[model samples]
Target: MAVVNKNQLLDFLENRVEGHLQEAIRVFQNERAEILLQPAPDGGWSIAQCLEHLNGYGKFYLPQINKGLNQANRSSNSEIFKGSWLGTYFTRMMEPTTGTKKYKAFKNHIPAPDLDAPAVVAEFIHQQEELIVYLKQARQENVDAIKIPLSISKWVKLKLGDVFQFLIAHNERHLLQAKRNLKNLEVADKS
Candidate 1:
């Protein structure tokens, strides 16, 4: 992982979360339930399912992040953030870009076919709001010193900064997937 200014990293993440929140409010929230529920042309998850899968991750991560933040006592004068190799690898894999390989969602994280679209969207918005607040709080502590446990294993942990990076990247990946699903549905409707 590359070394970066801690504040700069947090600021960048905060902006991303803000963008996601705005998109949810401006776009996803206004989408009809049927449209949101409509599955992708490839038979993948629907838009609502994508959001719900993200929500499942948020439920696991947000509380863990809060706990880590509260327990952290180390304060660093230097703003530099050095992510662990593992952290970097995880964040990079989760980032959504053209040609990123698809991965199956964990069985626990997979969302049900039947979901209340409005409520799912609302929950996602709320989680993003909470994430923004956590990012702000992280500035007061040494991100490298605080370790948050992974959802998959309690024994394995990542630095606070890495957790933020990974979680945000995961969110971005799923949000893009949801938008793609919506676009495919629209195209299908026209056809």
Candidate 2:
């Protein structure tokens, strides 16, 4: 098990989690439904779709995380968090890197093109807030020992720490995609 500074990890996750929250709010304030629903010039997912997809993931993971946190054995806070090798590997795989490979969403996670833009955005914002709560709860739990089953396959499980890392990275990846989609829409409008 690889050890990490628990305080540092918490701070990192908190900063990124709040960033997503603020980003979602900014998107809600600045973009209208038409702009959010506009598809990429090349027929990729629209900004609304990107967020809806994330919401789908959140719908599955958030509850499981909450349940895990609730059931986790009460223990004194550790100064360091020990990460499982498999979980760490999965998190690293999902994280965004320069020239990262694109992954297709599983069928159930795909959002319909006609999804309500405002609702999708609002759901994402709500989910991020819920995730922030879990991050705080995690400070008191043995995150490395609590296992969360994967939504994609029930048999596959990951440590809570890895789950947080993976989900946050995944959200950031799509948020960046949504921003790019909006930028492309702007360029098209000006053309």
Candidate 3:
């Protein structure tokens, strides 16, 4: 996969991710619980649940990614020299859901809450806000240098930018899940 410039991608996220996120939130606000928890016949997620998961991991990685970005070239000891537990928890939880033993994008895994979105995403967002406080310090060249040995693959090092891309993709994946769920809801209603 082509690695986009961190600053460029960050700008893209400011508009694109935010817009999609706002729309998804609107869907959540309008959704009923019956539709949110269950998957459609086609195996898709409801809008509310998707928001929970999208924010779930973003909330986790934003802080770590920010830490790595902010500390670029300044100190040998970046806060994320070792990543946070949130990322680790996220992976373990998501394991049963996605059915993969290991992650390809991140050396350390980030998990999804096995139970629900609200609890996980709330934590995710709080840290994200903290990370955002110093986002200006983030730069592409610097972030690219950030690396960590893979927990699943000791030989591999996961780059910081790839983790960022994964977060964006993860959001989109859940957003699509929500859309598909919406369609499923419509079909169920029709039936």
Candidate 4:
């Protein structure tokens, strides 16, 4: 993927975060957990599980974004610097010097079979709200300056701003999975 432009990212969020926030809330307002958790035919995650799994990164990104904002500036090449685990993995796999490589994908589900859908949706909403607050509070200068490890996995380091970008992209990727899960739910209903 192309390196995200700092000013462009700031501008993009400034213009779009509110919309994304609202859109997310609207979609989530009516989720049914049982329907969501049912497995898909391709053996992928249920909607409930995917949402929970996607938020897994907030444990790392939320704190890292704060650190990037508080730390000193290293604006030059911040985005380009090798990422911790996720970033490094992405960089090496998607190297400009190398031919295209498949984007590796994975998923997990926290055990909570009894948890209701709204509760899980509530947690996701909480995460999105936290992200909105963080992104809104961040400065363009900080966006260009800070780089944090993408994971303890040392996949790679990422620009603090890119943290949000990855978050949005990652969420959408799973949301698509959830939508697919819905289709599977439909197919099962027919069967």
Residue-level lDDT of model 1, residues 128-149, one tens digit each, is 9999999999888889988999
1-191 per-residue lDDT for model 3 (tens digits): 34345566556545545655465455554455556566557644445545665454554556556556655665442332222344334433343345245334342232332435444334434434443443444443455567544334546555664454445555555566667777877888899
lDDT of 4 by residue, 63-167 (tens): 777777667553543323222455434434433234144344543334344446676767777777777777666643555456767664455667565566556
Model 1: CA > 4 A from native? 74-78
lDDT of 3: 0.50
Score candidate 1 by lDDT: 0.92
- Spell out the clash pairs found in candidate 2: none
lDDT of 4: 0.60
Candidate numbers, best lDDT first, in rank order: 1, 2, 4, 3
Against the true structure, candidate 4 reaches a TM-score of 0.69
Per-residue lDDT value at 107 in model 4: 32
Best by lDDT: 1
Q: Stretches of candidate 4 above 4 Å error?
A: 1-5, 13-20, 72-116, 154-156
Error of 3 at 128 (Å): 7.2
For model 3, the superposed segments whose C-alpha errors exceed 4 Å read 1-6, 43-56, 75-137, 148-155
TM-score of each: 0.96, 0.94, 0.58, 0.69
> Candidate 2's residue-wise lDDT over 39-115, tens digit each?
88889999999999999999999999999999988874466787778777767777777328877788999889998
